[model samples]
Target chain A: MAGPKYVLEVENVHRIYESAAGYTHAIRGVTLRVPRGEFLCIMGPSGSGKSTLMNILGGLDRPTAGVYKLEGVSTSELDDDELAELRARRLGFVFQRYNLLPRATVLRNVMMPLIYTNVPVAERELRAYKALRVVGLPEEYYDHRSNELSGGQMQRVAIARALVNDPALILADEPTGALDSATSELVMELFAKLSEQGKTIVVITHDPDTSSWGDRTVHIRDGRLFTEEEERALIEAAMRSGADINARRGHT
Target chain B: MRPGDLAQETWSALSANKGRSALTILGIVIGIGAVITMTSIIGGISNSMAGMFGANAARVLTINLHGISNFTLDDVAELAKNIPDVEYTMPKAQIQHEATYEKTKVQATIHGEVNKVFEAHGYKLLQGSGFTEEDEKRGSREIILDQYSVRNLFGNTDAAVVGKSLKIGNDEYMIIGVADKVNTFSMTQYDSQSIEGIVPITTAITRLTGNPNITSIEAMTSATSDADAVAAQTKEYLSRRYKLQDSKEEGATRTVSVESNKQLMQQVTSMTSSFQAIMVTVSGISLLVGGIGIMNMMLTNVTERIREIGLRKALGAKRFDITSQFILESICLCLTGGFIGVVLGLLGSFALCGIVGAGLAAAVTGSADPVLPVIDPGAILNAVLTCVITGLIFGWYPARRAAKLDPVESLNHQ
Candidate 1:
């Protein structure tokens, strides 16, 4: 792998949020590269702006000023329709809340992405079934409604929905944040298995343990990515300032 | 999206909020149903009224000369020639007489009339033919018998008696035909002679009256003729022509009053039109309210499904697709309501027809058999089309609002 093909790339991205409190720089001059098949984790405390960067990477939001290339296609140059097309075909997203439609059957929820895709109508259900099977959901659960499922099972169905389109990169924003440790471990094991199968995955979380599951971890704080030493120093200063550093981390 | 797929998606969306959808649809159903019911009832009433007065009766004018015993066939013909749009004119005279046919004698009416009077009065012939123009010219003694005269002579109406001679006072006359039973509410005479017999004007003037005097003259204006204006013209003409004989008292004058069916028919028409207008307005208000309800419900649908909208957009739905989905959903609801309305309207119309028909028949004919509803397929089609258009119009704003929502914002909606 002398010349690694980058599945995602972001350069000098900046995001500014304006409220009644005036402008807050959510992301400042952040540059990062995600190589193919690399399981990467972004670690940050509350208000560290990691979520903003994740949103940019997921194509759900655009940086106020920056260039983002998902699979070498510059996202900033694309319009809404094209961006939607890119999200539908080349990238997958998993949210902390398991954004499956509660009223839909598990199978129907998983097949949603296929509705927008150019895939033949007949192949959509079969693809959805395969994705559900890969997420370790039994065939019997495929017909059940999302609202009927436990928290862990819902997350699995969400993951299955993401994989149904077979995108090159999967972005997980705290995929197991709402799950118990045992279920979290099961989810991380699934991510590990996906990594073994040569799928590039980027997960955003504040848990060092969760980050450890990735091949590499990057810490972000105060609207910028920092070195490990710099991150440790920031935490020490936050502790001294009574910012509750213990609670900053998802797990102690 | 394919229409079938869109329909399937809409169905799914509606079923999720079943109560709201049903209620919204019900509003439309009630509105459309009421419109059909009113249309049917009004249609029936107009039909019955038209049946009672013969079709051309709307243009017929009755001229009665007071203190003057006679006007003649020549007088009516001269009126037709002088009046600008007057289509034709006929003469009629009536008196009571003791009619004896083949030994049976009955006091009955004897009318001096022509063939045109039969059509103007909607009198259908039951036996033999009517008197012709030649009969009037040759002063033929042919007569058309009425039901009363037929029963008096034969004890029951018999077709064989049509060719026989019947004596009225002293002269014996050959019966030419018999007429169907008719409603004679304002048909000039109500005595026993009013419907019992009809004879040529020539025969009446020469044999019955021994003079060229007619009781009244009937003038039928042409279709394009303004009955009101022509009526005024006829009245003016009659007043100008009928000279008063010098009365024994001062300030006494002879004037012929001209009465046209135009005024009576216009009154009936205007009354019914007013009723139709009021009922239509009520139905229109209900439909308008129904549309507003749809708008309210569709807006709520958009608000509640923000996350779903975002998800669909992320999944590859365009702005147009999202708009199409919401609009299709509303249209589906309205169309369902419309279908139900049409069915309910049909049932209500049938029921209304039965009730009205039974009441009319019992009051008039003493029977209870039901009459079929007056179904105008064109009206039904218009109602259906109106509902579809209503759905499209009412659903537009809400669907547009849903489409205009930012995808990023909606996806993040909790």
Candidate 2:
């Protein structure tokens, strides 16, 4: 059988959470596809279900009523441990807080993923060093504890950690949410550079400026995806209704 | 994850909170230490009690006749011949008298016995030979002085009192031999100023006391026979021969007392073992409490490291991986405490033995060897096994909780 043409495929996925109070439809019907080596950004407001989508895409969770495939393998069929294995070998995640072990050295943090993958000890350090070099982290800072580094340096270490495993897709959630604008620009530039190198990247964020770095941006509202043109139309229509209200207020 | 990696992770996690880890194992240390100390001391006491007699002490019995008895050497030989299990029998008698050797004088309890008494009591002849049967037959005034009596009448035990004349109750007897002090198990240590000596039964009867009566007979049972049974048979034979009655009614005066070494040993062994059992139960309670402490600390560790557990899971750690890591940590803690407890207990037992020995020397016996604690390898092995089992029992629930955590929720935990 031929391998999958797209790195990720999600069709009509739905997510529902049940609690003592009632049921919550976090995701209704969402479909998405990203071809190999494509940089896609999924943008949404708070509570807009972007995180839920990211969780499904990263195989951290299973879709309730959809077939989500990664590299031609359906993830919904995999058990918890198999999903964890998929995450370990096929996906890399970067969080907004730069979730590095606080007291561990930067090099150690970068090598953490390989430890779980049963990688050889000798190659782990070499791959971590290569990842660090690619992310432009200074060699002197490799031995320092992650908490001792600046915000930007810590994020760089996290990106190195994500890149060390060489996953098929890099999923970063608000990669620059904690950094200043200048440091954010530097991080986005690094992601752009990784994209230019034919590395498939998906960045989930609310900031338009952050999303602008991606090759394509998709907006989500009420658990539904919208293209750029459709999002513009929705914004213009909402503005038109507000203008009509102002005109009536003037007459009153 | 690889075993090396797992071990490294456990190390770092435990070392991160060194003070808490040390405090957590304190209960285990005390628990194991108490068990080790109690077993050592109790075991030592039991061993020394057995050591009080020679290794084959259970093979000997003593028969004492009282109240105008007419027991004689001929009767002892007759009893030895009649009793099926009796191997041999010797006559014994004791008399207190003042003894002197040229300006040195001492009070002594002189035993009238043959060489068999020295053999049965583990007495070593340090200087000279024992008296022969010829001397006993001739009723010669020859005596053998022990080291204590030798020291008392000759001013020092180093001087050979052999071939010298020693006045006893106005009769000067020739000293034929000098024997080492008999091991009475410190029974006579309190009588510091007194001495003891041995003489032929014939001489003691004809010369010293002017009596031809015997009072005590020491008998050794055959190796295959029980000492207690032999003693009973000996008593029955003597009772039948002498027409003795056990009742203390009017005019019933003759009685025989037969005691076996096995009987005395049985009583002492039962008492010591029961004491040991009670003490072990008390220590077991402490061990239980230690296990509970381990469980409490493990639970806290799981709660504190929720985010870490999440990250590891996301990095491909399975439930088994997480569980083993925590379990190994718990085992390490317990094993460390167990080993240290064993060392401390051994040291404590040694110190206690020294103190006991010193107290005995100063307040009771002048000198006796300290009771050495038995270092049982089986007990140490059991202690180690207990630690591991404790770790598994107490670490299971907490480790399960950690492994069962949802990665998403745990990663989002603040």
Candidate 3:
């Protein structure tokens, strides 16, 4: 599973939300580690803490109790600026809704993250175009607005935006949750291609078929790690066991 | 963001909502236009008045006796001769005389004045000659009529009446010349009687007229630059020489009234200034309202562009950059409004001037003709500055709110 080295190590991570009403514990202690260039899927039901964990890993949220290290820099110890720097340099994100700016063209949407970097506009545009080209969108589609694109095309633009910064890790949340089966296959194929290019990817999804796109699948229920397995064996077992008898069901 | 980019962005945003932007700017346009137009019109009126009074009319002084007292012509002559700065002192004997030119009779003011009085004042001989020293010495039958009098008697021809004989009462006199029209400053006292004719003091002494006592002495001085001061000094000297007392404080009073046209002009100017100030203030309110409109619109824009802000922030825009962008956009809006307002206001002022009868070319210093809008750089600067400040003051809150947004929350927003 390892090529270069471990890129992320998470140990005993816990997160709690406090309000006037009371405290809601979003994540219990959880531990995991991933080697470089591995495609790992975290499968969970709604409210099973996968999103919170993803947010922490992406440097968008802080864990209440945890030790998180990316290349030996402690995530919990960094300030806002440092966390932003980490996100900017190390992580790329793909949200479920695509999140393409309504007013911007596909190229401009891809260049959005590059605005935070010290990249010149020319270089940024070049990189954005390259990223879009990787997602199979032609140069002519670069000037097309987000609203003008189909659901799959919009998702692809979002993907191009995620990859434009050339981050070390990609975090995708329900990447094909909104797509039809055929479009979902196309997106999965894109993920498989990205993984083949040695880009480390983590996708959080409830669908086992989507999880099958990963090299390895990790299951979580009730804010606890349930199991981990090779993707091929997980898919084979899911097919034989039938959807109703799957252990991951009704656990969240 | 770079300033150029900011400007381009602002322009695009404004262009996108042309109707709203145009309407907002219209408020500013009307305000600036009104201010400039009103000021130009008032200025034009004042200038015309000044010109009508003669270029040096602003310096003319008039002296009068306070009340009916025993002040003699001898005393008046003595004062005129004794004053070191006095250029010409003439006794004014007012009398009503009827002129009969072939039984077409016209009533006129027969002013008895000294020989040199016409020249010392701004009188120009339109034809022939003025009263001579011989006429003052012998009290002969010679007179000078104003242009209007000549026009009325001879039917608008200046050459027809000069050198002709006209009978006033029982005496026949040769009209030596026609005097230029008197420039009257008092708007209320404009009439034909104000411009009748002038005759030699000797002729008045021989003809049917008033008492030998001079009603008032008309004095002209070479101190045209300081006419007010010269008039004041002459009044003071005459007061002492004649033992004149202040009528308000004295048990007895004279009919003398000493005044300077220059002082009157000063009062008029001050009044005009106050009027102009009020107009400028009223117009300023529209500019202010326009600024507020820009602020409100920008705030709305900020709210609508929250996702864009989040995207920008995520892309590496600093808080200051976002704030500057919004503020610049607002200023652009307001300045655009100001420029339109100024142009319209000028046009309005010119339109108003055309409606009024005053000569259009009179240059009023601080005021413009109602028909010609005056463009003052100071006003434009003030307006633009107001707009920029409005942008800052009003844009700050929204910009801060945008800058403070949680990037993740914003991105997650549906």
Q: Which model scores highest in lDDT?
A: 2
Better of 2 and 3 by TM-score: 2
lDDT of 2 by residue, B249-307 (tens): 57767878889988988987898889988987898888889889989999999998999
**CAPRI-style grade of the A/B interface in model 2:** medium
The iRMS of model 1 comes to 1.7
| Whole-model lDDT values for every prediction | 0.80, 0.83, 0.72
TM-score of chain A of each: 0.90, 0.94, 0.88
What lDDT tens digits, residue by residue, belong to model 3 across residues B174-287?
888776642232211224333367788767855756456565666666653477777778878877777777656657665356677778778778887898888888877876
The share of true interface contacts that also appear in candidate 3 amounts to 0.17
Model 1 earns a TM-score of 0.77
TM-score of chain B of 1: 0.73
lDDT, model 3, position B194: 33
- Report the candidate with higher DockQ, 1 versus 2: 2
- Which predicted model would earn the best TM-score? 2
